[model samples]
Target chain A: AAGVIQSPRHLIKEKRETATLKCYPIPRHDTVYWYQQGPGQDPQFLISFYEKMQSDKGSIPDRFSAQQFSDYHSELNMSSLELGDSALYFCASSRMGPVNSPLHFGNGTRLTVT
Target chain B: SQQGEEDPQALSIQEGENATMNCSYKTSINNLQWYRQNSGRGLVHLILIRSNEREKHSGRLRVTLDTSKKSSSLLITASRAADTASYFCATDAHAGNMLTFGGGTRLMVKP
Candidate 1:
């Protein structure tokens, strides 16, 4: 099975536009996570999904939402993108929500909001 | 506020030398993990040390945890230029399933 895959490696959008990022997790992984990283900064958790349900919601605004399908593919949707939302969005997957297991991450999708 | 904080915001070492980084957390944790991130790249897991374990080793990497003091250290032996990257420490507290990351330690290895 392939690793986590995120679509649209790079995107440029105007303010107030909507952007949807897609992710396909590896086979057999039940947990998915979303993180955002700014330039020269560490990644901050946004949200997570388990068993097609939203498990955790971090310090994200209301404009950000995510959905996990029956097949385990997840989509992160931004209803109204803002300049502050411009950052690298990363999709990650893990076998379970354990402290010891490492989270496998996709390359990331760079969103540019002008 | 962030739970984890790493000392020495940046580090520089010559090739074949050892590099050490420290992380401190404010709350009790179940485990602590280290991650490496190259320029413009996602983070890669390096190692994890549980609260019960005093030390853990994998290859040239050694991690030590002192839960009493709420601190941890990552030591990399024989570092190379490829090891040049930003390293982050994440803490998984007992109450939460999510891991919160520290600011980070930027390591620069000279060849």
Candidate 2:
């Protein structure tokens, strides 16, 4: 099966404009997560979804929101984007098995808020 | 907040040499996992060690976890140029499935 897929591989938007990024996790995977990576930095958690519910929210600003639909697709929305929003957004998925399951990630969407 | 701290922010080694990286974390954890990310790419799972286990091995990778000290170490045996990447350690807290990752250590394997 194809790995996780994210939309708008690269996006350039003017500040204050709204931007939405979409993701489709691997088929049969029940858990999905979103993470942000700044230049020369490690990935930081944004939020997580499991079984179509928001399992956890990370240290993101209120402008960021996410939704899990039917346990397959998840979308991350940013309103009134600021220059700080420029970074790589990654979508990850994993099957609910042993708690030791490792997350499988997509290539990620590069969003640049100019 | 995350519970782990990785040491030696960066390491440079010859392709045939060994590379060892260390991590220390606060609080008890269900498990600790290691990941590798190539430049501008998503992270790839490397190995995992449970709280109850002391050491685990996969192919050429060796991982050791010390619950008493709340520390872990990753050793890459006979590294290759392709092994150059940023390595991170993540902790799965005893109470949840979410993983809290540590600051990564970038490794450069000189060919």
Candidate 3:
């Protein structure tokens, strides 16, 4: 089975720079979710989209924005990046509807802000 | 703030021993899910228990949910060295599909 695919498995950026992370969800999956995991910390929900619409938001920073394209892929754009933003960014996908459907995760993109 | 809190920040056990982890949440949820992550890798979904369900089993894994206490537990039977990883419990609240994760329990299974 094809799993969710994240782009730029590893990214390095400097402070005040801009970066964009992309996620290609599994086929037929209509929901995409973004999460951040800092070293030795739990994963934090950032934002989510359902059927190409923003369905929920969590602790995502104002400098970050995300959108799901018509093809069901999503992109997370971070501007004015800060060193604190360095972490593992994960993308998960699930079919919308069943309450018991589990989220399928991608390998994630490691962002290192220098 | 995360919605769930997992017990035992870390655990070490020998292979063939059963490993168990507990999770407590703050709010009512539609379902609770357990996931495993190997070091520096993506999360792998293990099991999910609906709010109305008391227990569920998959392969060597068993998950129990107690809605009354807003708590859940995951047990891995006959654990192997391959089971060494971080386990996290996530809750899907009535609010939406966003899953709030717990601080994860690190399990090290020795062979």
DockQ of each: 0.60, 0.55, 0.76
lDDT (10s digit) by residue, model 3, range B1-111? 368689988999999999999999998888889999999899999998888899999999999998988889999999999999999999987545789999999999999
Per-model fnat list: 0.53, 0.40, 0.78
Scanning candidate 2 chain B in windows of ten residues, the lowest lDDT window is: B92-101
Name the runs in model 3 displaced over 4 angstroms.
Answer: none
Clashing residue pairs found in predicted model 3: none
TM-score of each: 0.95, 0.95, 0.98
Best by DockQ: 3
User: What does candidate 1's lDDT look like per residue over B5-29, in tens digits?
Assistant: 8887899999999999999999988
Docking tier of model 1: it is medium
Q: Is 1 or 3 the stronger prediction by DockQ?
A: 3
Instruction: Report the candidate with higher DockQ, 2 versus 3.
Output: 3
User: Candidate 2: which stretches are off by over 4 Å?
Assistant: B94-96
Tens digits of per-residue lDDT, candidate 3, A31-89, equal 99999999999999999999999999999999999999999999999999999999999
Q: Please state the Cα-based DockQ of model 1 relative to the true two-chain complex.
A: 0.60
Task: Output per-candidate TM-scores for chain A, rounded to 2 decimals.
Answer: 0.94, 0.96, 0.98
Q: Please give the TM-score for the first chain of candidate 3.
A: 0.98
